[model samples]
Target chain A: MNKILSTVVLMALVVVGCVRQDESVIRIGAAGPMTGDQSKMGIDLRNGVELAVSEWNEKGGVLGKKIQLVPGDDQADPKQAVSIANKFINQKVAAVVGHWNSNCSINASTYYHTANIVAISPASTNPRLTQQGYKTIFRVCGTDDQQGGVAAEFVLKTLKPKRLAIVHDNTTYGKGLADFFKQVIENKVQVVYYDGIQTKDPDYKAVLTLIKEKKPDVYFFGGVYPEAGRLVRQAKEVGMAIPMVTGDGVYDPTFISIAGNAAEGTYVTFGKDPSGLPTSKAFNEKYTAKFGAPGPYSVYAYDAANIILTAMQKTGTTEGTAVAAYITKNSFPGAFGDISFDKNGDVTKAPYVVWKVTDGKFVEMK
Target chain B: MFTQQLINGLALGAVYALIALGYTMVYGILQLINFAHGEVYMLGAYLGIIVLGVLTYWGLTAYSLVLSLLVTVIVSMAFCAAYGAVIERVAYRPLRNAATLTPLISAVGMSIVLQNFVMLAQGKEYKNMPPKLPTEGFNLLGANVSPVQIFILTASILMMVALQLFVAKTRLGKAMRATSQDRVMAGLVGININQVISTTFMIGSSLAAVAGVMVTLYYGVVHFSMGYSAGLKAFTAAVLGGIGSIPGAMLGGFMLGLIENFGASYLSSAYKDAFAFLVLIITLILRPSGLFGQKAMDKV
Candidate 1:
């Protein structure tokens, strides 16, 4: 009787193990911060990927096999992202669409590269990500250099402040972007104050107080929305009244909500606002119908998903090597516009536009 | 410029002092560095935010900001005090006579558990308090000092004074002092050592809660993980002040705040956190007993 029970348990284990990877479906992984501070962005990315996959599956699937999206929640953490990458590798996913934060993508891509699994990030923009020269890594968004350069040009050509201050959260993304911005503006503009702040620091009075002494006309904060909002609010409290500029990290409406009245007149550098774009019309309509409204990265996530699916279709296989090769050779017409990759697997023409927050909305400035 | 930076340093130091007192007090009593003490402060800030958020949602913020802050402080203090007592009863009490490493491990475990618990309950995002406080400030020597800074400084001093009086003037305080000197002897001399220890944890945690609330308001945001950095700095302050000395902890906290703010202002902002640790290293090298700490002679 014990031998019979053991045989039954072994069969059960086999059945459970085989359930995830069925022969009829091709698995692709979607990893992001499904729950946490960045859950909205993660959920938006997952929705976009799922929507793209479902649309493809409805149209007779990709390469005569149903596309299945395996979702993993990395919680926007670097360590968790690496674990998720390992999980995707174990599941034998052909490609992964993920890692909204740059540091997560930078860390997780190392594992994906080792496993030869193609990873296309939707939102990470740290310059070092592409500079690492990994064949398995690709991003559909602009790097900090591109975004920060555009911001610096806009500041120098348009706003043209005599003195400027650069502040960052001291993380890889924040500091990297600030450094990029500084590199462009340092020669033209009189750079007065530059500082790095703790990410979760509640107060910015000390830093703002020092900036007040410097009295910079333009203050660029190279951090995400939460910290940027605090800086704006606290800067106003300290009576600094300077115009603040930031990267695409503050494109969300949450920044305005957090900073309230202080968010007005603040400038943010975004790659492109896909909502009003002619190409994104149908995608935006369908996205709003399903998920109320697409987030800042939803179109990028959709484009990322589409680019991977397109590569798979062109190559006629779910194999990572063939798909990545196809991706490198071909250009994708996406919601953001024509997306092409250079030798570094970075988008060749990652155009950036500046937008100023006017009455709680990002209005593009020409 | 100098005056502005000095005021900034003092304001930052005041919050650090409140948190350091908790570490110093617990260390004074048990000699067990309660690593979980930081989480208590983090939870206190969360409670303050939650209470304020609920009150604001109910349209009570229009009633009065001062009243709302008072309610937040009281509620946060009560909840944190109970939590401190319970943590002592459960995590620390069980391993009372165990190996030294055992309770330390338990404390670390407790810290992680508390952090995750709060993270699960309140989503792991930076919760921002609306711009409720009056942003107006008075100018002193060309430096703007906000009412919030004045309040933080005043309240911290008041609490420190109250704690000093409680420790030095009351019978419970005497019992606490005696228990810390020798727990077994204090127990034989009709002092409830366990009760003294619980009271010590409660007081320490309550002070930390007040600091947590002040920091939440001062920074205008709070996150579940905020405790780790604040706790680390406060612990450093406690050690800098003389780990087991209350006054030493207060001085250490101020010194750390001043060093960090001044270092960030004068030297480089990237090394703001490093300045505190640098001073701590230098102080330990030169005077191992800390600035205000008495030299601890080998008892045996």
Candidate 2:
């Protein structure tokens, strides 16, 4: 009797394992520079996917099975990103959620294409990302063109400054945004003092000095917050505060810490609206309850994750091709708003909100 | 603009000098370049920011800055000193007689471990440093002189002077210098080589703590990975001046900083790091022994 019971238990265990192995649950791989200089973006991006996947699994995951999210860190290097992509493909993941930067994503895109897998990016905004119009490439966030148009419109109408000076850090994202914003707003405003600063440099006093010489009515920075913060604080110290404006890239709490009081009058353009959106109220409450502090990018990240899950639900399949097709063909409501992708898999809903650094916080400007 | 760049480079070079001291000192004695030196700098900054953040959160506004700075130095130095000594005994001591690359690999591993440890303790977000030495500027020589910059330079100088005195006047200082000159000879002369090595590591790590604190005060922010960039720059400074010479290390750091600032201001700001390394390459090709290092007769 004891031997019989043992065999029965063994059979039950084997059946359970076999059932688990048969369907091959929705396994998604995410990669980013989670352990290097530009790691914050990867960490933030993973947090979005993690929060979404965990929630999906708890709610009886896609196709009636658990979802597994495999994370690989690229450490922000282009070479590392490609290697990570090959690893993800080897694992036969249903989809991939990474390569945060354009360089990394661009390198990994070919690998994902070859593997017959769809790669969704939450952050990489270079226009060249989906220019090939690959069936598998999708981006949840607006591209530099969308963001630049919004910024140009804001600079043209809201601020209405007579002259505009653009400074970029010369990265793919930075230079792209600067060039697009310059082209759009150059006719509307007097363009002066166009320049590029390096990211690793600790000082920008000369650039600030040149801007002072040009004395544009407004200075628009197309770079990350690290350099922007230095420029902002130094500009204030040297008394060149002509209402410095920046893009969505520098719209984080780090800027406030870096620039201090000088950041108070600064403005940045981003797609997400905080405290102004009626639809995001529920998300804001849940997010604040879970995370102690509320960073600006959480909403977009959550939206990206939720939209991915919603796409999976729509197709009723974890197959990358089917899901990607469904995602581009339909619209879905996410924490940010309704997300609908264009033919090139870019988010069609383009809305830019202006935020002012009021009292060391990103307060809604309009 | 030149004056501002010069001053900025000087200030930045001073910070690198303090860190390079640790790298230079450890390399001088053990010939083991502690890869975790950057992590020590990072840990020090994090400790300062965390302590001050807690103080501010607890509403201890009056003495927050002074108290946090004092505590940050003590705690960070204590932790890093222990880390350095233990790392030497466990990671390096086993491979003491092994090929040089073995110890270098161990040091690199130690760096990875420390970075990951710091990441887990402090989330990946950038922490805001407490307000210290207010962001007020005084115009001097047509450059907007930050009183804050003045404080940074003065404080860094005092720390270096104090460090120099510690090495020159203290009992352990002579032993360390003796060991660096010739470890086996010092051991034969009735001095404990291990003790001297431990002492050197302790001193280098302690200096890194001071650098970490000052940098946070300067940047008004700290990140877990802040040490990597600063550490690379400082290591370059150490090599640029002279790998084993203290004064050379200091000179290298200041020179690197000046090059970076001048390059950023006059040349391309985006290529500042490239410019710094270009200078190093030029220097290495021209003077392999560094600015102050003496060229020795070839054994051949």
Candidate 3:
């Protein structure tokens, strides 16, 4: 009889533990690659989300409850992204701001739509991500279609080379950007050499030599910072000194550091510098004080988190469908400016600008 | 273009040969592949960065690039050698008499552990090796070869020659040969089997360290996962040349490098890695014992 009583006591404690976890707190999920090669970007995204959540909690949170952040690391992979989405759904988070990679965002959006949970991707740029028509999916960044077209316009009007060479890392984002650029410029100029390179290989001399032999007047590469750095460095090493242009994926401080002196004279297409705007001054100062400097996508992540929090406050409830519906129908002030999602769940006004690396710094090209 | 690609292929092959020697040496003695060997090479590169960073801070690099590089290479090689011995003792020595699969699994586990450990300690970003050498190069038939590439090729060749001499002429070398030939007989002759095995690992690891340092100088970038693809290619080179033969490994490394460069040049560059494996498959089917491997025989 004494043993049976102890067992009954243990079961009561378990029931109380589960109930306490769900009481008086609003949970928001943040997903990104918190580990692996892209962990730096992931950590930056997490930091941005944390800053926004903490600020909300300091303001007494939404509906008189404390705010909680649930972080999931997808490791920048698609399959892992689906698992993270399911986990967030099981945790019953009101909204999500995450999935930095385009592929991850695209894969996880299906589950979020099925569960009626809102997910706002801060950095995924592939056009297919928003083209899927998932009502629950949203993004703060511009699509590759816009980014690539901007780059192509710059190449044709500004650089105006007779022969151009295009290369990509063969990833979803890279290939998509390259293809879009090609669609715009294939008839205007001669594409001397076109190919895809394996990411993270660290040796591009073979391909660089081939491109050098072709004698293209300008070279364009569609990839992230790591491969971009290596490609330019190796191209310089191989005596191919042509000017190179790339998409926003190569627009990080890490690229300059990795490429060293070779980074000079390279052009990158990205959104206009938002840190200099008066609206973002406070966010920049707070972020810099906490995490050294804001990473390339930190501002977007901060805006994404704030969008979710504002939607929750206006709806006055943590229900997924209700909050998502309110977010789609309203405009909210963000770190960049006023952000309004279109019917397709994309930012309507994302302006792409070209920046040049001059004297080891990325300067906005007027 | 052909000459330039040839030069590029040679430089890449030299590094692969350096790494392949480690795989070949370990397999020569214990008949077990050290999957953790690549991690050792990676650690060697990280060590190079740390030491080089310190030297640069003290202005030693500015004083003399050659001296600073020499000190960095020596220090990194020493540390990696010790690391290799510890790995062998803790992970491989205990399973020496167990099923061959046991140590193989342990090797893979150790590789994962080391890779993660470095990732955590170094922060997952790619650490740039501050360029100490001049990038200027001499042009030959429209192909420019940088000074750093020349340094890599010369350093690799010198170390390989030194290794060949050490193995053929030293007392320790003779004991290693005896142990590889017949461990029981060598132990009966009062040879210290443990010491011989440790020495082999030390030499192999130091060679890999040298290769690691060379790679950083050549590429000017290094990361935690750099070892995985490099180690895989070096392992392929070792098997293609003959798993246990030193000279065969060198020959195989160069051939694979040239094949990859030419294949990428003439065909699709995206399939660059695939070419190495294709050659590996054809080699395996055409000559099961490899190019230089002796035919297998059953003991009576």
lDDT of 3 by residue, A106-134 (tens): 99999988988889999989989888878
Best by DockQ: 3
Please write out the lDDT profile of model 2 over residues A174-205, one tens digit for every residue.
Answer: 88889989989988789977878877554566
Candidates 1 and 3 compared: the better one by lDDT is: 3
In terms of lDDT, which candidate is strongest? Answer: 3
Those runs of model 1 whose alpha carbons end farther than 4 Å from true positions after fitting are A1-25, A32-43, A54-87, A285-292, B53-68, B294-300
- Top model number, TM-score: 3
| Model 2 residue A214 lDDT score | 71
Residue A185 CA error for candidate 3 (Å)?
1.1
Residue B2, candidate 2: C-alpha displacement in angstroms: 1.8
Better of 2 and 3 by TM-score: 3
Q: TM-score ranking from best to worst? A: 3, 1, 2
